[model samples]
Target: MTLVSTATLLQDAYARGTGVAALNVITLEQAEGTVLGAEQAGLPVILQVSENAAKFHLDDPGPLAAALAVLARTSQVDVSLHLDHVTRTTLLHRAAECGFSSVMFDAGPLPYEENVATTREAAWWGHEHGLLVEAELGYVGGKASQVESAHGDGVRTDPDQAREYVAETGVDALAVAVGSKHAMTTAEAELDLDLVARLREAVSVPLVLHGSSGVPQPTIAAAIRAGITKVNIGTITTIAFTRPIRQKLADLPALNDPRQYLEPARTSVSAVVAEMVATVGLAGTQRS
Candidate 1:
């Protein structure tokens, strides 16, 4: 299958009523593995490079873009490169230049008015370049941008404020604060279904759950049923991919080559991705 652009995949997901998987890609192996997962599952997946990952790699978005281009050229599945949780205007512009089809601007932490203003500008820039722009409103617990305090210490997104923000920002999607945290090791966290339904009734644009990994799999599916069109899974996939690598390296002290370890880790990422695709896209029958 030809690699479909991010806009087509996202729009198709919205139209088909399924949540497309947007997996975070950090290292070269991760990108390859995500592409493999999408190919194996026959689903179009988005390769998301978050702001932290951008800085982690010395502010070089080039490698990730190159990696996606390689995947797009070679794979039989559709793959879209995306920039996630970006706040800096300079970095956002850089990602656009590097061939990102979409960017998720996280202005939720700032003052309400400022969040709207900056996000609007970012959206305008993205629209000018024909890129899909997603803006987040209301602060959720355990966002990576926050420090010194963890989840449960953060503020929840008010439904009215979310409506106002979406009305103000004109974003393609709106990430709202429900109950899930950012990086939970366990999958026992339950989402506020009532809150989700309320927001669904309140906001017209698609709703995005920020901390998806912490939420239970069933709750995640229910969130989709509750009208969430985009679900982001990062922490769970990271833990699933990394813990085994840690163990494999620890067991084999002389293991120096990453291929010996990262190969099996691909299976871990694929397993979680497969599950997400199966669960979220249950009622979604249309395919591009």
Candidate 2:
């Protein structure tokens, strides 16, 4: 079989009541590290480049896009490139047109009606081009200065809104904030399992848990059991890889070449990915 479509793989995971980790990549190192992790785990990993990352590369998607495509083709495990948390129409279109298999249109800052309408329009664009659409729960919770909160400031998604949003927008997946905080340095972020369960009962499409890094492993596993089909993993990997690398550099003061230090970083990240994939029940489930 040719490369597996992210939509199909994610849907399968959703059906199996498991969550797939989507790692964010902003640099070649991040891409390499992520692919190495997946290769080590013997599983395909979703390679996501968020709007912020795209902007950092001079408002162009070419470099990151090209790198991921090359990695996807060469990597041992499947690698699906995705554009995450897009807000601008131009960038959203650019992402899909630039060769993303799927993209998330983050309308979490818009009014409920506007969020639905905009997402529907975006979803149509995605559908017309045979791309998967991932929409937010309209209650994006995080400390990102640029990201606006939509589910009414400080309040997370009420279960009813989730069902209505999915029905109205026809999105393939939904990102819900259930007490997990984004960009949190600590791994102590607690998740509201009750809210997650309510959302599971309320929405039919695959449920996405954002800010997932902050939540503990058991809580994340509990969320998987509670019907979360996708887990967005960034910060966890950040802490897992970075902290150790920093210590390594301090130990080896004369090492200038990246390979010397990054090797350990890659190894560390791969271990984390393997455990996470197993914990999320994605191991031994690679599709042909």
Candidate 3:
């Protein structure tokens, strides 16, 4: 298994009628863990770095992107490096130049016409560089650049607008808002299945479900059945990574070495990723 295009992963999932797991990677450890998780589960995965994570690394994600690219190349399972929820043209270009296989150009918060214009430009440029481009049609209720709000605040993606936006942007994938919120610690978000099915029937491109960390496992599988080909997950994996580290540090107060704790935390994250990959029906899949 070698590094593949993000489009390849999602397209394979769509062909197989399953969903691909896209996890956010914030650190070198997280990248390693994600690749290992996919390997352990024998699934193809998208390892993504969000705009916020890039800024956390001082807006220069070259080092992290390079690291993930290397891991993707060396990993035993199919992996892709992706830049998620990036709005700034400068950052978007930087990510493409840094060897990311794809990028999510978020313009969901912009006015309908402006979003189409900006996203279309990004899609054109991204394609020229042989990178897969994904754009959200409507807001998904999250942080800035991703969705521009928190808790979704009752913003839903209109099926008609979704059709028009996809036709206008020409993105490789379209993230639609049904009824999920970002950063939910609990898996209690109720999805509008009817709306999801309608959008699936209306939009030609593959659909992405944002704020998936809040959706229940069963509901995630249901979303996939209803036409969600890519599921973006973050908070839950971070929580899984952190919870173990907290426990380790509390149990051993004199843990001066970072590896002693981070190793276990990384393993925890890997297990979580593997579980999600299985839940999405991608485990043991070799199409990507």
Candidate 4:
């Protein structure tokens, strides 16, 4: 009935053998729709703001984050605010200041040592600030200079390396790369279930799957069963949010009010989110 910690959601999913859906939002509509969808499905969800999305708001996501925090507090189901794929330490601190319950500190593109050092610092800051920290160990593309590798076979998270990374960084959750490519327009990424299970066993922390937009429904369920507790979805929300707007614009050329088209797009995103929640087996699963 109110905002909860990301750690609670992840731990609950791990205990239940299910996946928690973490959706990326750009606008307030997306944020509202994400929570509305979760409420409709009677499931708890995480509303995330990505680094690129924050840049779109002029590098200050405070307003949007505050809005999401309010929405979570007033929602009928549990919802949490999280910063996704953050590359800078400043941004991570800003996110916590903005009332975010958790953040994914992205240092996977850096050298292993540098990444470990930076992530450790982030985890320390997060813990001190009362925020849950999520960090990625292997490369999962589709942002910044990593765009070139967005669609390529991602560097799978090494089991041994993952164990060490968690032990050294003290991250609350670990996002693993297991063949899911970011920014995919279609759902066709083939996941390595065996690797997922191996990584789950190797790492003591809960596992996260990035680029989940490219993963189909059945595959997502299978990945969850194999030990993925958190699944991050971005591209599909954009697709769902834009398709109706384009269609409405084309159908009504004289429509001057933005709400006329944007409202439909927001509704579409809500439908997609509800569907994803159900697919992740979170629907109707009440939180204690």
Candidate 5:
């Protein structure tokens, strides 16, 4: 299959009441593993490159983006590239040229008016280039700081405000703070399913769930049923990819070759992706 657009995938999922797995990609192996896992499940997947991940690769996303583009173009199942949590306008501007079909312009932490202004401009530019633009509404905490209680702290998005924000920003998707926190190693976050349903009814576009790695599989499925169209998973994938490598290194201290460990790590990622796809009820939902 050829590389597809994220808007197309999300629209289909939104209409079908299913969720699409948008797994974070930090390396070539991770990107390959994502596609392999989606192919294994016969479902479409989005390869998301975060702003931090782009900075990791020498502050330029072009090389990694190019590799992902090639991988998606040749993949067995439908695949879309997305730039996730991009705070810089420059990066948003460069997203289409980098072969990304969608971008999440994160301005949620800023003042409400500022977030609206920036996101609106980003959506306008993204539309001009045929890119699916996504933006965060409420602050989904815990990526850079200590994990906050998912249900407390006024972090959850307001349904009424979300409706206005979407209309004001014209974004294609909205990432809301339900209960999950970023970088959580444990799957204990309890989502507010009622809020999810309310937000779904509040906005016309698809709703995105960030920090989904912290939510249990059953809960994820329930959230999807409640109206989460896109699920952004990162921490668990990194944990899965890193644990095996650590174990291998501990078992073979003198192993100098990278492939010996990276191969198993990639396999771990593939397994996680497959499980996540099933969790989202997207298994065997491949499109022609």
Candidate 6:
């Protein structure tokens, strides 16, 4: 299959009432594994590269973006590249040039008015370049500190505000804070399905659930049923990839070759991706 547009994929999911898996990729192995897993499940997936991941590659995302583009073009399953959680305007502008089909302009940390202004500008640029733009409404806390509430009582996205924001910003998708937190190591987050349904009814675009790594499989399915069209998963894949490598190193201290451990790590990530696809009820489903 060739590289596909994220908007097209998400629109299909939205119309079908299914959620699309948007898996994060920080390395070549992760990208390959994501594609492999999607192929295994016969599903379409979005391969995401976050701003943090770009910074990890010496603050230059071109090489990794190019690599992901190649992987997407050669993959057995339909794959789309998404630039996730991008706060910098430069990075947002580089999305189309970097082979990205969509970008999440993360101005959620900013005050509401400022967030609206910045996101609107981003959405305009993205549309001009034929890229889907996704923006967040509130801070889905968890990456900075685990102790913080995943669903900050007053920080959850209000359905009324979300409708206004989507109207004002003209974003193609909206990521709302229901009850999931980022960087969570456990799958115990309970989502506000009512809020999800409300947001879905309020917004004109597709709904995205970030911090989904912490959401249980059943809850994830429920969220999809309630209205989540895109699910962002990262931490779980990291855990899966690292656990096998840690065990492999502990069992064989003499294994000095990177490939020896990374192969299993990659396979582990693939398993996680495939499982997530199934959880979202996309496994074995054909992409339109």
Candidate 2 overall lDDT versus native: 0.78
- lDDT of each structure? 0.77, 0.78, 0.86, 0.86, 0.89, 0.88
lDDT per residue for candidate 2 within 23-130, as digits (tens), equals: 887777667777877777776678888988899999988788887888888888777878898988998778767778899999876778998999999999988887
lDDT of 6 at 79: 88
Q: Taking the tens digit of each residue's C-alpha lDDT, what string does model 4 give over 1-288?
A: 898988888888877778889999999987877888888888999999998899999999899988998999999988888998899777988977898889999988888899999999999999999999999877776666553553355467889999999999999999988888789889988898999989989987888989999989889988888888898998999999989989999999999999998898889999999999878755223322
lDDT of 2 at 247: 88
lDDT of candidate 5?
0.89
Score every model by TM-score.
Answer: 0.91, 0.88, 0.93, 0.94, 0.95, 0.95
Per-candidate clashes come to: 0, 0, 0, 0, 0, 0
Query: Per the 3 Å backbone cut-off, how many clashing residue pairs does candidate 3 have?
Result: 0
User: Which regions of candidate 4 deviate over 4 angstroms?
Assistant: 147-154, 283-288
Measured with C-alpha atoms, the lDDT of residue 90 in candidate 5 is 86
Q: Which candidate do you rate higher for lDDT, 3 or 4? A: 4
How many clashing pairs in candidate 2?
A: 0
Residues 1-288, model 1: lDDT tens digits: 655667787677777767777788788777777677777677777788998999998888877787777887787777778899998888888877888888998887887788889999999898898778888766666755653232354466678888887788788888877777777778776777787778878877777877778788778877876767777778878887897799999999999998889988887777777776566656344422
Model 5 pairs in collision: none
Task: Write the residue-wise lDDT of candidate 3 on 114-212 in tens digits.
Answer: 999999999999989898899987667756445554335547888998888888888889998888878889998899888888998898777888888
Candidates ranked, most accurate by TM-score first: 5, 6, 4, 3, 1, 2
Full candidate order by lDDT, most accurate first: 5, 6, 4, 3, 2, 1
- Residue pairs clashing, model 6: none
Provide the lDDT at 114 for model 4.
96
Candidate 6 scores a C-alpha RMSD against the true structure in Å of 2.5
